[model samples]
Target: MEFKPDLAASNPSIDFTNELAQLLLFTGEVGVAIQQFSAYRGNLNNNFSFPSDIEEISQQPALDLMFLSDVISKVSGINRLIRGCIEINNYKELINYLNKTIELYKAYSRPNEQLKEALKGDPYKTFSNTYLKGFVDLDFAISILEAIISKCEQNNVGAKTA
Candidate 1:
């Protein structure tokens, strides 16, 4: 997958740079956790004896927590970065970051919804709380991001000509 550009390279603020680094690092952790979880699940599917309770699969809960925490950190960091961009009147960078984030959110939204639906199939009603919270937070984050983007676009007249 293509990654975001080096945003900090052009940014002069030390705090923004530091926060961006932390966000990127946490994002990588989330990606790795998801990759490992997918691999583990794929392996389980190939095995002769599959665990009846999918949640009982080794490392699933831990990975879920990691994913949830990473999501929270990354989302908050993105919000902070947005504010930083606005503080510096860097509309170009702000729009770039917002578009990238929105693109990612759109790409992942369907799969996330599917997973949520799957969790609802559990008759025991014992779902992964971490997973649910992550979903809720992600939805909220996207809503906020979209609203910001709408406002930006609405006020962005003639920015392209500048």
Candidate 2:
């Protein structure tokens, strides 16, 4: 979807600076939480009970037990918070915060080498490494915010030149 610059007005009801700051802070907490989930492999039954689709049979990936990971839920909350902050008119500052958040995700999103290999084995043998990746979802949200910033910049520039 195209970014609507007009919709990027700052909402008097919301304190975007604080909101963005909180999102930035939560990224690290989420990263640590995900790291802790590595121990969950021992608790979850890695074996898939049944084949659901081609991705299951062909890709042979696990059921993405990450859904059970609290990190996913927390990340979703962060995404929602970020979405709310998108209405801020400070495109430059918003973009800066977003880029910083993206960097944090990039630093933490890589599944450990051991977990990566585990996810590749028999789909039925593992409970994770399949579908849900919260980082990707977070990245999509940041990308949308970046697009909106770009559009806002364009609109303002065009208006000044005209």
Candidate 3:
């Protein structure tokens, strides 16, 4: 990961806490609602136009269990990463982890209308301003990390030649 001076300088404690809280609350509420909706839709016995994959999976109890298990695993992993970042006071790592969480949320959250609505408005900007204090660009941070790694590799090669 890159050593972002701004990431080191900004206060991560409050921002991380708020972000974590929001993620937990949002996922818990929205995930259950989505699952319940899926179950209800299955009970209706009418051929609703859900995605083919979802329709197939909804028919089998085993598949539904597996789907819920996968959701739990992803959410748990995200929570652990957020907490670990907070413990270490690593703002950059926290941002990276949050971005990953957002990606995962985007994947599973599409089916739920309420979740979609909640996340529709410039949620990323809200999160950035509240947690990162408007000082960091996550994409830039990732590029810096890559550059640092490349520089280190070049230095190692030069040392080998000398």
Candidate 4:
């Protein structure tokens, strides 16, 4: 089903709640993807072995590439959810939730940056690194959440006009 924000609600609180619920759902999806990626990486590492046959040398499995693509897709979904939330009117409770999400994103940034730098040259190495996809997802989520928080603050200020 296509998720669309309720744009015509007369009550701003209900609208904000709906938007927040969508954000929370996507955030939970990211969390699940992170866990699944971690498990897949661990399994890949344990089973990985250099090919002894010449024919097999050129046929490496594309697990890392596939995982990276999955992560990008999920992050894009989160971005859409953030955009939906941005359409909702500002409320104090929504701002508080956004602040907490911003903090969570901040925590996800440090390791992501370090890993990106460390794996800069090779696509395989970069994508194969366990934390890269998770970090990239976090970074995207953080950027979108920050934008929503800034917009919400502006809306809050403009709403107080006499």
**Candidate 2 least-lDDT 10 residues:** 121-130
* Cα lDDT of model 3 by residue, 1-162, tens digit: 534343323544433344445445545643553454354545554555443345433443343344344444655665555455445644354345445544543544335545436645332322233222222233332343344234323433211111
On a 0 to 1 TM-score scale, where does candidate 4 land against the true structure? Answer: 0.37
- C-alpha RMSD values across all candidates: 9.6, 12.2, 14.9, 10.5
TM-score per candidate: 0.43, 0.31, 0.36, 0.37
**Global local distance difference test of model 4:** 0.46
Per-residue lDDT of model 2, residues 1-162, tens digit only:
455443335443222454445445545544543433344323433443333333422243223334224323544544443454455433444445545555544433454555446545332222233333433244444554455445545645211211
Best by lDDT: 1
**Which is the leading candidate under TM-score?**
1
The local lDDT score (0 to 100) that residue 87 gets in candidate 3 is 56
The candidate 3 region of ten consecutive residues with least summed lDDT is: 153-162
In order, the Cα lDDT scores of the candidates are 0.48, 0.41, 0.41, 0.46
Give the C-alpha miss distance for residue 110 in model 3, angstroms.
Answer: 6.6
